[model samples]
Target: MNKSAYIKLVNGSAQTEITLAEVKKLFEHYQHMTSLTGQQLGWDYKAAAFPYTMEEKEQGGIPYLLLNGNQTQLYHYLIVGVSQEEETGLHYIQIVLPEQATHGDLAKANEFCKYLAKRLKGELHLFNGRIIYYNPRK
Candidate 1:
């Protein structure tokens, strides 16, 4: 099974929705943040061509952005899928980790997940099924 994490948009939050372009931009921001540190993730995200495609609703498909890893860099590819719940219409941004992801990669993923959760003010569901609330405390 593929390891994955999720950012669930809570109702009444400042940001309860996200666009594909925004998701791409967030990933770009993440890549930049990683590069700003002393160590880079060794992935050329700009050239990787994260594609966005929408399928017909009748076909039971949803819009999604796929970010592929750089094979030349020996990096394992991860996937991000955006989906909305049918009943509540809440959105979820899912980050799927590849099975071959290294320990460093896993740590980086967690960092990214936390960064996203904080930015979106949403709850983050970790790969291990633990949920983290990033919203401000009342």
Candidate 2:
């Protein structure tokens, strides 16, 4: 199941805000903690992999992550920005899996989403609108 997942940081009353610093910190942590290498399949293509290092880039002042590949072309990325919703205006971060993403990519995305939500005091919103990483005890 190749799908996207969002990590949204909400303030009191679900107001959206830009949390660039925190998001950057989270990205840095992800980079430090993960080390995955793609498998060699053939001369032209490689197996979809995970834990890829993402580079920070900005377009129109919005920050996003680009999966870094040494020899292969990659399209997977993570975007960090504010949500467009008027009522919930919240800081939104998302992991966009490439269309060719494999099961490993999906698992990694889910794992990272959970980690990010816990660390940033955020919540994971799946593409289907299902929420995760919420601690009912808290």
Candidate 3:
């Protein structure tokens, strides 16, 4: 089986600073995505507890989330897709799975994304830019 995963940005101190409710929402969102995707695809989805981070440079600082995961291929997709920062904060919360997933698996992933986008009341960004289904070249 091909491994596949999803990713997004959660609560952070970038704009207004992170809050309890925001943090709770982030976790809840992750759980929802994981459960939904797992149920549909028959794969175990894991959540990364560590928040994405970036090292501050001595001069101008560039912030980033240093996410590490078991699936290296999916890791790249997750980092690029869900780690986007808006003017105030992140675009969406991120979740990731294995890269050994199939097309049907990704279809199910999209469903979870749509569900999250609706729940978060925000736009769901996928495939690093395009608004279509995620079809990264393997």
Candidate 4:
């Protein structure tokens, strides 16, 4: 089984989906671009096994291309899973850690999740099921 974390929007029923390019840009902005690759999804990413890839995946009936490869710390690939339709405010994006994830990976993932949530000004659901709000300070 794989471990996972989530960065959900606090503003309920606001957005539709989180885009991968946005996540990649965030990684680049935060100097964490090394966390994910620009390789094509389902092709170069898995075969390379290079820890992470920025490739977007098109899931069944999904309207948006999944974003961000887990340092931006996914061992294989990162997917943006949507559990709802248009108004997927919460549960918008999930960081599904690869099965090969370890304690160090989890730690890094948590930190990454925190950073993302804080930057996005949303809520973070940790792997342990703890919810932390990332509202702007002040």
lDDT of each: 0.67, 0.57, 0.41, 0.57
TM-score of each prediction: 0.69, 0.61, 0.34, 0.58
Pick by TM-score: 1 or 4, better one: 1
Order the candidates by TM-score, highest first.
1, 2, 4, 3
Tell me the tens digit of each residue's lDDT in model 1 across 18-111: 8766877887776566455524555654343322222212224655554444452444555667788899899988877777765544665677
TM-score of 3: 0.34
The segments of candidate 4 whose C-alpha lies over 4 angstroms from its true place after superposition are: 12-17, 32-53, 59-91, 136-138
Per-residue CA lDDT of model 3 for 1-138, tens digit only, reads 333233333342133233324534554567666667777777655343222222222223433232333344333322212334567555444433346444443554555556554444444455334453222223
| Candidate with the larger TM-score of 2 and 4 | 2
* Model 4 vs truth, CA RMSD: 8.1
Off by over 4 Å in 2: 11-16, 31-50, 59-61, 69-84, 133-138
> If candidate 1 were superposed on the true structure by all CA atoms, what would the RMSD be?
5.6
Task: Report the number of the highest-lDDT candidate.
Answer: 1
Q: In model 1, state the lDDT of residue 30.
A: 62
C-alpha positional error of residue 13 in candidate 1 after TM-score superposition, expressed in Å: 3.1
Task: List, residue by residue over 1-138, the lDDT tens digit for candidate 2.
Answer: 446788776653132454556566766665544422222333222223333555677788676666543324333343334344557665567777666765555565676677777776667797667997543334
